[model samples]
Target: MIERDPLAPSRWSAEYRTGEFDEPFPWKPVLGVLGIVLVIVFAHLELQSKRIDELHTAINARLGGELEPLRGRFTARLSTLRAWLELREIDGPKMRAADLDFETIRSGGLLSVRRKRSAPGGGSSIELDSDEFGECLGVPSTSIARIQRRLAEFTPELRDEIDRTDHFLTLRGMQDQLDRRIDALLPELSLAIEARFLLLSEEDAEARELMLLLVDLESGQEKLRMRVPYEGRLLTARVMLDETTRAKSPGSIALPTELPKGASDCAAASTLREAIDGRHSIGEPMPEGGEHAAE
Candidate 1:
């Protein structure tokens, strides 16, 4: 081999030229691209965050301004309806008792009396006075009239049923017939009550749905909690009405197989057959031997 000159450039001189060091490292171009990508990602994220904040603000404003007021009105109406239902339940028994007392007085059975005494010789003597029999059965006419007026306040169907009951019949058959009519009417009354409740519940459901849409906006949990009591009242009223409508036994009444097509239009007929066969006490028991009559 020929001797190599130490000062001469080698075959790999092009690959390791001084120009590579004179220029900047290749990392600068990669770093610039990376910085540009980071800026784009940050800007995209900020835009999305701002849009979400704006949506939330709109939802909050609507909930506070319009939806909240509407919800309050629904709540108040539902509360009033619940109270009225409770009053009707309590008054039912009182009205029935008044009817029974009035029937007892009008029938003349309450007025029949028989007195027995030991005779001077040995045998017992019997004395019958029809007029003086139930002197104690003097239930105030005002009381009976008051009950009649209250019964009229119920739905037209129920008021019509009370009107059809024969007031001139004797006490013996009058009480039984009146009771039968009442038992038959119970189911209709229950259905009427249920119809009203269902209407109210539908309105309440709409309000609740609107509230759910606003959950992410603000006070969502608290608003939902506030609805619980109103919902409970509605459920309770429905349960009681359903129970009355489905009863199969005599004392417990039920609707006919063919129910009225329109819940609000179920009017009482001129005559109602014996729907329930068993005897049922509507209110507090009369005193022993009818000594004390209903007030």
Candidate 2:
């Protein structure tokens, strides 16, 4: 390093210096300015973040207020729809049952009038097996008592279904109780055999059912009590069966020497060559024509 005199006189306006910093750089002023700039930038960023959060909160609040009523209405509508579906579910089986009952009622008259055999009074009726019920003619109370005794073996609920007038049932006592298949009563409610037994009644609805016969569709098994007679011309057979179906079906009577052609249920048709001179119980066999009763 060169030393210069402190009192020397300056002669030029421009001075050229070949010397630079001989000690460490001065850093305090630069650091102070940089710190001020950093503080300003950080404060600006913090303010922007706070404003952005407040804007988001305001937007969310406005949207929630607008949608609250819509949400409530939607919830109520959904609840109403669910309730309606539930009600329909509850009524579906009932409606189906009612429809089936209506159909049964509509065809009930035709069903009752379906006569495979003719009655003495020319009304609708069925003819029973002769050997089983030939003695039921001219005496009804005995047969009725016997049938009632058999019916006693059944539950009162099932006995209540035997209401149709002239509805017939041939009880075999071989099938299980009627209540056992009672659940299938509706689905299998059909009549195919009316020539065996007769269930007599006076009224339709308020009438008491004294007899019932049910035949299973799948098993061909019978489910009722008692047997009956099926035979004879309207003229002779009806005389023997007086007051059974309807009061007296005979007119200008003849004892019926020979049953009408193709007619076989005539009580007088016995090969014994005589009219009804003796009374025989349905359980007894006649001395004529090998006429035996069925169990």
| Tens-digit lDDT string for candidate 1 (169-202) | 3322433454454444343333222221110011
Global lDDT scores for all candidate models: 0.28, 0.29
Kindly list the per-residue Cα lDDT of model 2 for residues 1-295, writing each as its tens digit. Answer: 3445556775664666554214444589889999999999999888766655554444334324433333345345334323211221110110011111222222331111111234332333443211212232221111222322332454444333322112112221212334243322312122211122222211111221112221111222221221223233254433434666766554656554644322332232232111122222222322322221121
Task: Provide the RMSD of all predictions against the true structure, rounded to 1 decimal.
Answer: 29.3, 34.2
TM-score each candidate. 0.26, 0.21
Q: What is the lDDT of candidate 1?
A: 0.28
For candidate 2, the per-residue lDDT at 63 reads: 29
